[model samples]
Target chain A: MKAEVVVIGSGISGLTAAALLAKKGKRVVILEQNRRPGGALKRFTRRGIPFDIGFHYSGGMGKGEILRALWKYIGVWPRLAVLPFPEEGNENLRIMDSGKVVRAFFSYDRLEDELQRVFPGEKQGIYAYLNKIREISNTIPFFNLDLPLTPYLHDLFSPKGMSLAQLLMSLIRDTDLHAVLSTPVFLYGVPPREVNLTIHASVAHPLYSGVYAIDGGGQAIVDAFLATLAEAGVDILTGQKVESVLIRGNQVAGVKTSEKEIYASHVIYTGHPTSLLDLVPGEIFRKAFCNRMRNLINTDSMFIVFGAIDDPDTLGDLTWINYYNIRTGLDIMDLDLRHPEKSIMINAPGRRDSDSTGASGGVLLIRMSVWDEVARFDQGVREKRSAAYRKWKAESADKMIEQAGRLWGDAYSRIEPLAIGTPLTFRDKLGLPMGATYGVRHSMNQFSPGVRTRLPGLWLSGQGTLMAGIMGASLAGMVTVGEIEGLEPLWYEVRQCR
Target chain B: MISDEQVYQQVTQIMAEEFELEPESLQPDATLYEDLGLDSLDAVDMVVALEKAFGMKMTDEEAVRSVRTLADLFDLVCRLKNRQVTKE
Candidate 1:
């Protein structure tokens, strides 16, 4: 059967695009490679202990935010059980910087005050940086849904045009501020430094307003999307890997899956854009476009420790998310997982719905490294691994657990490791190219692909298309579908969504 | 009642698809751990896959410990389905 649109890869972007297009009365069928629908946001349970894959929490889910409106419009907000991050310094997500434990705050004002309190010597720099981010946030079209499209010239000249690293250095001479300021880039999935002020502002601004995690973790959002898609009459075909985007002359006609062919006039791809080279006929894209995509650096992947701490006291003390840098000298830049010269420490106790502070339990995602360290073992088969490689992975997890014990104090000792997902796990299980967690690296001054592709009907979406994380991926879906249906209508829907 | 051949085929398909192994490589007598080298995570995925494929809910988690061979899995699934059928 021919669909109005064939949405590939059922991540946030694909689901968002399918829902929106389906709402517009377009026949859409989302083809997911995995047996399950959620792309990065899929949650799984082991011995009844729940763990979220990509999704931890989201910002910009607050009132009047474009992300909030989009979620409501997509029927996601109502289904999701979201809560604010702990505002207090002790219980709140802690950042260990240069032997100083700086707690993160959800409120922008609170964050600023805390930063000022901690870095009293750099008061002027702190104020300037906060003001700069807010200014950068203003330039984002999605942030102010009421505003018309942010003009290209505005983008070229604004603070969004500068690198967050460059901007931070220029504004604050303090090294700690530089590391702390760019931590938002990790939310979008890059380790740090590569993210520019524009990408940084759009992705980071929401967290300062309010950041929230779901009650059932990412599963809640995925389940909501499934219900919405069903209600909207958007057919979902899981485990259907699109082998190729079939073309008729110069335009995209449809796609062929492993089992059967799905014909659609339009195809919105939500996977890593690099994978597109295999699907779309190579001749359709220009030489430069192909090369850029081929060499497009993936965002840094992570070594996630998905565990449950049953100790009620420790669990209560633990927060769901944190960017804990255990390594001193404040080198957030190079986290060499091999030598353990640098490390990213985060202790998130996976929570059961019964308790807020994860007294029941939760998960912590520690940034292991960029793909370089684990790329050697990428060729190994998933089901069967060489004993040597398996031993290495086991040893690595053991070391991380040991580090957690050191960094998090006595609470960490009681914590038991439930599951360890390495970069290889993501690459094998999730199908992310090189296990890059945030999709295509959203680097400053780099050429990232937009919604439109040279191939007429095949467009791009997902994290790579716009910003990273749920908000970015959702916006990207809008951008891609807007290319087919008018952007004005999406904007109108965004405004009208209550 | 499901035939032994039908049960074997279903078991083979689910295990093959889940593990990304060739179906022909799996024999009824072949051990899941030793022959297919299916690890702990792979076993979890296989169980989920089995539930979907056979449309029968596995009652006993202990079945995972005992279901070592493809034949063992076939019998486990058949028994689960048979129990459901009898109950229904």
Candidate 2:
């Protein structure tokens, strides 16, 4: 196969990059390893209940927002159906031990009001933190959309040294308040102490601005991107794993997949940064550069239970609420990885059929976990795994269900474990090393790999390149494509879309 | 505290290792983009490498963009290191 550009990995980043490039008159081909596209955005059905794997809800979907502008520019906005979260109490943070629940509303004023209502003494600190997030997020060039691009690139590349923990310590004194404020860190899979302040602010500021869920879950997003790509005349080759990036001299010639070789001058790799080392020639990148990619720290993975609630009446308002149940007095920064039950996120993406009298709702029970928990069971593929691994996985799911039942009430006990995903499952399915949930950790301690590499035509995108989450990955695609076709013109076009 | 001479040596060493340039070729006046063949991407990585090597936060955008030669980088490192010491 021959094309002007070959984009490896068909995740949001890859799809976004392909759509944008194809729209700009470049012939693009997307090679995905799995049978289907949409890396994490892909959804599965078990017993007729659909569940989202990676995407749940996102921010910056409001009118005139960056995500909206980007999606509109890429032609996925009109096709997508976004349902905004309720104006009040979109997210509920529950401390299990104290039974204290703090709700976060959509708007800043309402969110502040709710916080002050919950923590009466910490009003001043809450204002400072939210204002800081807004201030920092406004300075981000693309995130702001109105800001000039060149001058702020330096700020994005060289982040401020202060970690989120340090910044929070300077403002807030209450420990529980700290946990509530830092709950958004789970979205990016970084601890508050290690996550950079600017990165955290960027992630949190959007949610504060607005939060919305897609109409049909993550698969809807994949369908929208696939339709847009098809309209743009971009070809998507699934079940083809890119084994190595074919290099001719100093430039990337194309890629060699498991099946065949596709020739193209420009190659965009949106996979994990470390995985790049195995695909490229040993001599292309310097020893230090290669070492940096290899030694890059990964974000923690998760142990997820995908099941359904047959009776929607059991849980009132099943659609809008995202529950973060944390063990009381436990530092939310460090989730107990050894015991997967310590901290859990319960999300119900609404009932399948709101009009049907017998409607069942899909619920995802996610516990943050480390790869070491499932390392012993990582010997084979998903189906071919040993019986011991299956037994361990079933046992782990039972414990998570038990914990969820204790904290979230008996509605969770009725949830049959239709599917369970461990770090091994993530590693095999998403092709991330150690099943690192968000790829490389964007922490204060390390520098994230740049979009451009030592190789002339090979570029990097996706979570590892920039930030994580749907918005972050989409921005990575925009940034990588912008780097190719001058940022000024692209930003100008995106601004016009807004 | 590290002296200016030691800082210069360490900066040059890091540059050589990171960019695969020989230490002998890293002259004080060698241009980063021209003589050393570094691009904009390399400049970003250079800041990260220097920051890690010196154990200091190189968040000064003006200093990073102003750097054109090996001497400029060494000067930036020295200034940043001194700034860290004074803050301490």
Candidate 3:
């Protein structure tokens, strides 16, 4: 088979790149190792009820927003039904230690008022911090369509040394306020002490604008993307694992899957950056570049408990709100997996549906976990794990359930654990190294690889290349295609949608 | 403390190894883009290699952006190293 561009891994990034490239009159072929596409966006079913794995809710989908404009430009906006979260208290932060709860609103003015109300004496600091986030987020190129595209790379690297922790401390003095602001860290999987301020602002600024959940979860988004690709005449080959990227001299010739080889002018790899080392030749990349990719620190993984809410009525009006149940006295800067109860993000995926009944909705109790917790049981296959591993997983789930029950009373008491997922589950299912939830960590210490590679025709487009999450991954695809098809024209078209 | 000559040698060696340039070809005044054949992407990887080799953090964006020749990199590394020594 032959194509102008062969995209590896049919994840969000791969799908986005393939769709955009095909729309630009290029013959694109997507090769996915898994039987199903959508990578992390793929969902699972238990007892005939659907549950989202990777995506839940996102920011910047409001009218004229960056995500909205990108989706419109890609022709998926018409297919999606954007469900915006309530303007007041979309996310609730519950400090378990003190039993204090703070609400985060969608609008910046309302969010500021809420923060000021919660922390009585920090009005000035709250205003300054929110304004700073807006300022830094604007410096990013695609985040603001009005900005010039000449200094895209330079703008991203401008605020390199400053950490989120340092930035927060400089602006605010209250420790509790700092913890509240740091709740967004879990979304990016980086600690406040290590994550870059610019990266943090990029993730947080959008949410400050608004938060929204899609009507049909991640599966719907995947379906929309697949439909777009189909319309663009891009061929998708699932269950085909790419063995190696065939390189002739310094340029990419094509990719060789397990069954056969397909020739192409360009190859866009959307897997974990380190995985590329195994596919390409040993000497194709510099020793320093390879070493950097090998030593790149990954974001922390999760221990997720998927369960059904027996009765949605038991939860009352709190059913739809996302909860960040953080333990008191725990440093938000450094999260320890040993104490899972210390920090947990409780999400009700099914509650996003307007017609969701009590029995059909599902709840996900996700705790940030390190890979070491399940490393001892890594030797066995997914279906046949050791007895010790099962015991540990059951105990962990029970403890998490107990904590949730205590926090939510009778509503969580009826919650039954349908399945448990450790980092290994994420690794095997999502193909993430050590099951890093959000690919490479955007930290102060490490530099992530760029979209362009040392190899002439091999480019990278994934969460690892740019930022993390749906918006970041989608933008990464646009940026990679923009690099190939010319950025000014692409940006101009994207701006037209706004 | 490492002398200026050692810093120059180390920077040139890294450039030679990482960028596939000959050690003799790395002149002090040779332009990075035209002479050494390093593009914008190569500039990023070079910074990573230099940081790893010296065990120093190249946090100053302005200093890194100002590099156009081998001599500029040597001076920047020396200045950062001296600052690190003084801090200790």
Candidate by candidate, in order, the iRMS in Å equals 19.3, 2.0, 2.3
* Candidate 2 local lDDT, B4-78, one digit each (tens): 999988888888888889888899999999999888867766776776788887777777889999888888889
lDDT tens string, model 1, A317-405? 45544646643322465665455434556645345343545344655647556677676666664456567767777677667667677
* List of chain B TM-scores, one per candidate: 0.87, 0.95, 0.95
Candidate DockQ values, in order, are: 0.01, 0.45, 0.51
Displacement of the residue A235 alpha carbon in candidate 3, Å: 1.1
**Which runs in model 2 stand beyond 4 Å of their true positions?**
A327-331, A337-341, A350-359, A380-383, B1-17, B27-31, B47-88
Candidate 3, residues A418-440, lDDT tens digits: the string is 99989999898888899899999
Minimal lDDT window, size 10, model 1 chain A: A152-161
Highest TM-score against the true fold, candidate: 3
What are the per-residue Cα lDDT tens digits for candidate 2 across A1-498? Answer: 899999999999999899999989999999998999999998888877777899888888888888888899989999988888867546788876677898877678888998999888888999999998888888887568888776765456565577888878888877777888888888998888888777898789887888888888788899999999998899999999788999887899999999999999999999998988999988898766777788788998988998777775786655677878875431575655565448788887635323323454678888887888888877766458889988998888888788777877888778778899999989999988998899988887677888888898999999888888988898889889989989788888988887
Candidate 1 vs candidate 3, TM-score winner: 3
Proportion of true inter-chain contacts also present in candidate 3: 0.50
CAPRI quality band, candidate 2: acceptable
